[model samples]
Target: MRFTLSSSILLAILLAILAWPVAGCGPTPSAPQAAAIPLESFSGRVLTTGLEAPWELSFGPDDMLWVTEREGRRITRIDPATGEMTEAITIDEVLVDQQHQGLLGMAFDPLLLQGDDRNYVYVAYTYDATPDDGDEQDDPRAKVVRLTYSESAETLGEPVELISGVPAGSDHNGGRLKIGPDELLYYSLGEQGANQFNRYCAPIEAQRLPTLAEVEAEDWSAYKGKILRMELDGSIPADNPELGGVQSHIFSYGHRNPQGLVFGPDGALYAVEHGPNTDDEVNLIEAGGNYGWPHIAGYRDDQAYVYANWSAAPDCEQLTWTGLTDPAGIPKSVPVQTESAWEQDFVEPLKTLFTVHNSYDFEDETCGASYFICRPSVAPSSVDVYPHDGPIPGWGGSLLATTLKNGAVYRFKLSGDARGIRDVDKLFDTVNRYRDLAIGPDDRTFYIATDTSGLTRDTEGGATDQLANPGSILVFTFTGGRVKSASR
Candidate 1:
């Protein structure tokens, strides 16, 4: 259906005439403004530095923030109110800073310090036997273990393997873990070097691409790129979706390297995925559903691939809006054509992106994978979707996240009562760059983690060479819709 020059121009004019009246329309009466927010900044002292590739943050039962550092193989504690940091314990048995390996994720048992219910910290780390010498991939051992905390000594005691035998590879070792509203430990698992079709192994003979739920059931014997839900004791839940009369632990599947997981105020699970070069996605997850991956990049209206049976398919038409430009410098979607022009103008590169996959395989082959990796932004990673004064007011329950590449925290707010999801605004940004954010108990205070390796620094630290010191964490307090200040 190629478009003729005159026909294209006429069609564009007709569309423009129809859309001009609604150009500035918004769902809300008080539309987002163009002015910069004078954000307040607060800086907290470095709780604990000298660690390597620190990732993941959560508050402990004591109300202090608990942090995990990958390379240093240690779990540290921070007194958010006092700015004092303490190293609780280090896992000397686990390896750190290896390609796709390290002490990756941690979650505290909500009920800690009970008699028989003594709470424990669940940790996912690289368990390779490889020495500190280079070439960590050859070791290949990654597992999830629970570390019990002893109040007397202020340390993480003996480790117990909650789940084991998870295969590892140079890439695709998904390590993000979170305990959901249901009190089940939910974590993502990468395919560990399996073919792309492994992502589609769902629906049995139904032939439809597996939904997140179905993919999780893709036979743990062959599990990859799937999310699993299990009891704190590591037992499969009785209610888990069953296949062929066999109970499975998978919640959803068909995800390519999901590094971020968070639950919304309404109990919906949200995940950020690395897409194939062009598409990154933040998915609202449901039970027994599959998030279309290898088979479908972004939302495909063409519906070339069979989406998971119960997975609500993405609206592809809305995703076609890429902010590219025509030869004449008029901004348009990719492959700008005169026949079909964007009714709405492209604003800024979406300040908030949920999925950011790269083209590089980051493994055996050096070839480009073609997945678009989201770059870093100087702006704050947080965005807001709620309205301060509107029909549905008050903390509209926005979700905040960060990027490892460019260190931008992205906050997203949801409007409308519809069960489905919608994109809101790319609200305010922070002065410093960081990834992964935790909303303080106060709700208004936000904390960010910065990787020292990549930032513009006084010295040019080469990429491949591991730096003894990598990054620091920052704290910010946002009051009245702006950041107050940032702390070290």
Candidate 2:
């Protein structure tokens, strides 16, 4: 044992052991993982441009593209083949704020597509609610209206007010309207951007349920942060869920800015919502279900998120609003609650776009003052479910969610049950804010609506105002080819 071996002999012994493959320690044998479809396999082109703040994109029964212009206060139809635009209607009553107002969602009745006499289109928009007594100026409110379409004249007119006066503000006016499979109108409303930015001192009423008295009086103040189910005539559905011992138009509660609502092939309703700083969510919406908002973000995982009630501060007006935990300006008077503090039963999200630990840095100098966009939240604007027999190979049963911050489309693969997400893939990465998307009949072609102007992350991972396509529709068609595969 005292005798030492030469350096060459010792090196030879070490090499032999390193080359030996130990049982259960070597790489496990498995099928190669399918990589994300390459951008090169897709051909992209601008369909049209020079629009003003396009919001929603839907294909009508006539195979034309219908779009809502938030600033233009107009519903326009586009010929998908020729890109010729036709103004369907101009909402003169629409009150456009600095952002997130004006004409929003539009949906056609099922009978309209069946060539029946019901040529009706439902739309949501914001209008001035200023009191006659001059109580509040520039008070914005939201409503849903039914418009009759004239096939001969190619115009939409005879507007009938359905529901009105849902809480609205300069931001967080979640005005996504959809006609559910049950033949009921489902509308989403936000918390009016309370407890953040300019409205930092405003209290959030998302958890507030409407009383019987308020419902009888048609007061929709409590309708904020809720999804409403109503009949074609704008009356509450007879079979609507009774929440908090009161049966109103509210189908579900506890939502914060749900912008995307779609029905999957499985006949289940899904919603896409924005989180505070992180944890953008994709949820399977259920009747009378409560989605924890201020109490919990993504899950009951006490992670990076904390519901800091700035409005609860005694001197909240004096304290400068800083979107940070324990920032220098924020005092101890501000109340903060963890996700675990909420013990109430609620439905969890199917998936969170991104969730991070508390130790994650928020003050990245690279993003400068606009560091919020650099965070994990992608600012999801809309979502659409791909058919099970989609044209693109291996892309079936996936959700295509458009992001405003990332300027790209994220494809989330759904599990066989369609209740969970299997994996995620990013597609059509560009330097423009994607407002929404409409999948063509071919399913391989997708038309994406871009914001007129906004700040978005650039290719180099920096925030910039320069957009590649502004106020335009960009189309991406998947070409058949063998995509690259990688080991999982």
Candidates' TM-scores? 0.65, 0.91
Q: What would the per-residue lDDT of candidate 1 be over residues 466-486, giving only the tens digit for each residue?
A: 322246666655445442221
Compared with the true structure, the alpha-carbon lDDT of candidate 1 equals: 0.51
TM-score of 1: 0.65
Report the number of the highest-lDDT candidate. 2
For residues 1-488, what per-residue lDDT tens digits would candidate 2 score against the true structure?
A: 01133454334323321222111110122112235675546777788887899999999988999999999999999998878899999998898866888899988999875768899999999988875654332678889999999998989999999988877888888888899888889898889889988889999888889999999999988988898889989998888998888999999888889999888886788889998877888899999999998788877887777888899999999987887444344678999888898899989988776667667776667777778778778888988999999877788898889999867787778888998777666677677899999999889899999999989886556788988788989888888777665333
| Per-candidate local distance difference test | 0.51, 0.82
* lDDT, residue 285, candidate 2: 95
Residue 457's lDDT within candidate 1 is 12
| Worst ten in a row by lDDT for model 2 | 19-28
Worst 10 residues of 1 by lDDT: 456-465
